[model samples]
Every structure is written in C-alpha cells, then in structure tokens.
Target chain A: MYEERHHSEILEDVLQFIYPLIILFGLYIILTGISQPGGGFQGGAVLVAIFMCRYLVSPREMGRLDLIQKIDKLILVFILALASMLILLGFREVIPYFNGIYNMLIGILIGIKVASGLTVIFYTFAFIEGGKED
Target chain B: MMPVVEKIMYIALIIFAFMSVQTPKLRRAVVYLAVFSAGSAFVYVLLGAPDAALAEAVIGSTIATIIFLSALQKYKAFTVYYTNEMRHEYRQSNLFRRRNAVLERIENFCSGKDLEAHIMYTTESLQEVMKNHGWDIIVRRKNNKFSIYGMEQNYHIEEMKKYIDENFNDLRKLGYEIELHIGWSENE
Candidate 1:
C-alpha cells in the first residue's frame, strides 16, 4: 500500500504546496464565522482535508491520533464549561463586550473541537480499523 | 427562472442519492454520495441558507467521503497472483489460455461472495512471490500441474476449494493435478 502511494510524484509535490493553503482556508472559515456563512462545523470539516491530504501524500505514516483524540475530548469539555458559564451562570452580565467575545471564543473552541474530533474519526476509520484486518 | 434551477438541482440530488445506494462498487458509491452532498449544498444556497450549504458541502462532500473511502479500503477484496513457471512469457503459453478459463470461474465465485477479484499476473518464482508479496491466493502453473497456495485461516479459500472441487472435476480427469496447499502458517 505504501509502495502504491508513491506512484505519483506530481501528487506529492502538489500536495506539499496546497497543504498550507488548505489550513489557511479552514482557519479563515473558522475565525470569520461570526459575520460569515461558514462556522466551526464547516471550518472543522474543511480542516479534515488537511489530514486526508496528508494520508494521500504518505499512506504509511499514521498521524498522532492519541494527541488529536485527547484534544477532541478536552475541547468538548471546554465548550461545555464555557457554555454553562455563559448561559447557566450568567457570566455575560459580569463581562463587557461579552456577546462578541463569547461568540468568538465559542466558535474557536468548537472549531478546534470539530477539527480534532473529525481527525480522530478519520484516522480510526482509515488506519485503526483497517489495520485490524492485516 | 430560479425555480427551474432549483428543480434541476433537486432532480440531480435524487439521481445521485439513488446512484450512491444502487452502485455495486463502494468507491463509486462514495463519489456519488459526494456529488449528492454538493448538489444538496447548492439547493440549500438557492433556498437562502448559505450556512447550511457550507456545512453540507464540507461535511458531506469532504469529511464523509474520506471516511467512507477509508472504511472501504479494508473491504472484501480477494487478491490472486498468477505465475506461470513453465513459460517465462504467459501470453503465448497454452497453460495461459487454460488458466483464463479457470480464472473466469474463480471471478464468478468471488462476485457471488461479494468480493472484488483483484488478479495480478507476475513473472516471479513461487518462492519469491510467497516470501515477498501479500496475497490471498497464489495460482502457480508448472507444466500440467497447478498449485494453489492459501492461508488456513481464510474461509474464502475453503469455499473456493469446494467451488473448484465441484466445477473443475473435468480438468482433473484430463491429468491436470490441481493441488490445494493450505496450512502455510501466519508468520510467512
């Protein structure tokens, strides 16, 4: 499978060039989500392309999934905590410019959560489960 | 009118949805699903829901497609390597023609079992192929004898053994010794 992945040199070269651009685009979608059509979910899904592209470039190398999984769970906890603080505890009353800051913070957190969560899911399906057959 | 474009998108969405479900090959189905997702995203945009469109486009077309493809890589694909030892070039050999007839039967059996038959013709010696390649079955032809090497744990090979026994009884009567070599062990 690794040998088969190296069949196209052009794909590897082009992916190297396009990878950073994909990250930039995903980040753009995530950050500008407050005033734009795209939000955390869309940006996170776009970010998944980065890992997919990496797999395309080198099928043998399994990414740091444990770290991503950790990030996923940790971000989920943070989102819940932040949401509880804003809504249940009424922290919005305590802070100035709370709405914009809360929205931005939540969007960023959700973006990271979605990105890491999807990355973990992708790796699990692509590598972990597939590896069991071999 | 805008309604015409919306109708076209709806029709495309329905067509792609049906194609994704109806396709025999899993990879093609993933592609169809991606197209369906993209079409639905367009429809969402037309319905003045750009937010839903963005989400749909990214999740359906990008993430889901990758996940489906990854899952499919481990799907049932039966790999068979065919090597002719008596002749270095297989195309001109009489055994090659004979092997093709048997191969067609194996392919039919594979399809019946919902397995994609991935057959490769190699020039390597049996020992070299056995030592190097990852294969489900290796069909080797040496003169009139045919040796099929498979793992003991492979249930598909067991079914194939039965299939060959039932179908190729005529070939055995013609002095063609079809030997099924199992118990190769998992550790090479």
Candidate 2:
C-alpha cells in the first residue's frame, strides 16, 4: 500500500542490464546445488527476488497468477510422488549413479516448487490491498 | 560452551530485539526487526544450521521488512495546522502560551492513541489553508478567539473536541475564546 515513488529512467536501464546475470547466477546455484553450497531454497529465493525487483520497479506489469499457481501445484505433486516412489523402492538400495541422477532431478523440481511458492506469496502480499491479481 | 564471538552475538541479538520494539516510528521498528533477524540468522549458522540461517535471512530480513513497511504506508496521519501571528515568529516572548501549549496537548493525545502528529506552522489565512491541502485540524487565531476547524471524516477530532472543551473551556472565562467547528467535509 506504499505510494509509488518517482521512477528514474537510469534505474530501470540498470536493472534491465543486470537482470539476466542475476537469473543466470540463480540457475547456476540451483543446478550445482547437489555438489555445492547453494540449493533449491536459496536459488528459488534468489529467483523470487527477481520478481520482487520487477514489481518494485513496475507494479502494473505482472502477468497471470493462475499460470504460476498451476505450475507450483504441479511441481509440488511431482516432488511428492517422486520422493514416495524412491522410498517405496528402498532408496538406500539404489545404485550410486542412479542416486546422483535422482538427486539432480529432485533438486530441479524443488527449485521450481520453491520459486513458484515465493512468487505466489509475493504477489498475494502485493495485491492484497486491492490491486489486480496480475 | 560459549566463545567470545557467540557471546557478543547473543548480546547483540537481545539488544536488537529490544530496540525494535521500543522504536517510535514504524519504519524504524521494521529496520530494527530486520537487524534482529539478521543477528539471529548468524547465530543459526554458527549453530550448524545453514538451511535455517538462509530461510531466516531471506524471509526475515527481506520479505518481512518489505511487507511491514508497505502496511505502514497505509497508516492514517493526523496533521495539525497552527496559524501564527507575524510577530510570534520572531518574538519567543512566551514559550508556554497559546501555540506551544496547544501543540503539546495534541502531541500527548496523538502519542496516547498511537497516531503520528504533523504540526505545520504557517501564516496563511484559514480559508487558504483549508482550500489548499487536506488537514485533520486547523487552528486559526483571530483577535483572541481560536477557531478550530475539524474534518468530519476524522473520528479523532470528535474525541479531541470533547477533551479540548473540557480542558480549555475555563480559559474562555479569562476573555480568550475557543470555537470548535466539526462539520466540514473534504472538497467542499
């Protein structure tokens, strides 16, 4: 509900310039998370920060919420199904190479799930004061 | 089992929590809360929970602060306009009379009700002040009589009217007059 600040032409240009780099870094974090310090939660948070910055700069340009919600739910169900299947198949008995592949797949799913969840929360909070759902 | 660094961190955490609650401005409080969260996140990391630390840093410092600040933007403001005589500007002859006393009273009232008080000192005519901006209360002084214009939409003015009438009515017997006007709607 904060009043929109006076927009500067330079800031928008700067954000446009650096946005791709930030997305690339976030993707790198998520993809390398299984063997690195960053993981799905951290990478998803970084990705959500992009949406936050976008809203801060231009509030009226948000896209469809239904699409985001659908993607989020789909990823969540997929993660649950995959985890349960692994458990039922006795995850400990899985070969090392297959485990690595499963780990990467699950990490990707979790990253997508987290990104969508945070996007939903941010959008809900942003528009709760009576703006359009976009 | 506490090292010097962790001991200091605990102390900082407690101090930040206290200051966050004690700050007067909502925005300042939010900033303090963010700092508190940051300190706690560091403690979590030191305690061998990087996952908790990351979640705390992201949700606590960034997103929560933004949400609180956005909510604070909708906080209703109470603005008071004090019309001063040209001479009173330079002649601080009486510090506790008229304008200052009224401002202090309003300040107390606002603090009690957790409202922000914006006091404006201007020599503009009452009509000009009312015409230009939205004001909750405008105190116009004219020949020993103070005309207080209160907007109708502000419910606080009605309670203020009762308090002022009760407390300042005795001053009317001393030859100074106080008139309360509470029916002016905005844009009219």
Q: Give per-residue CA lDDT, model 2, range A11-112, as digits (tens).
A: 688889878987887787788888866778877777787777777677666667789999999998999999998889776575667777887888888888
Model 2: interface root-mean-square deviation in Å = 4.0
**How many Å off is the CA of A30 in candidate 2?**
2.6
Per-residue accuracy of model 2 over B1-188 as CA lDDT, tens digit each = 55777989999999999998997767788999999999999998888887778778877898788778656655656789888554346344554454465567777788677777888778776778888966789987777877788877788988898878787756788788888888865564
Q: Tell me the TM-score of chain B in each candidate.
A: 0.68, 0.69
lDDT of 1 by residue, A1-134 (tens): 64664557898899889989998998899889999898888888888888889887777678788999899999999999998887788877888999999888888889888888888877777777746334
**Could you say which candidate leads in lDDT?**
1
| Quality class of the docking in candidate 1, CAPRI style | medium
Worst 10 residues of 1 chain B by lDDT: B90-99
lDDT of 1 by residue, B74-170 (tens): 6778989888876666565764556576577777888789887888888898888888988889998888888889888787888888988898888
**Global lDDT of each candidate:** 0.84, 0.78
- Which portions of model 1 miss their true places by more than 4 Å? A1-9, A87-97, B82-104, B121-134, B138-155, B165-188
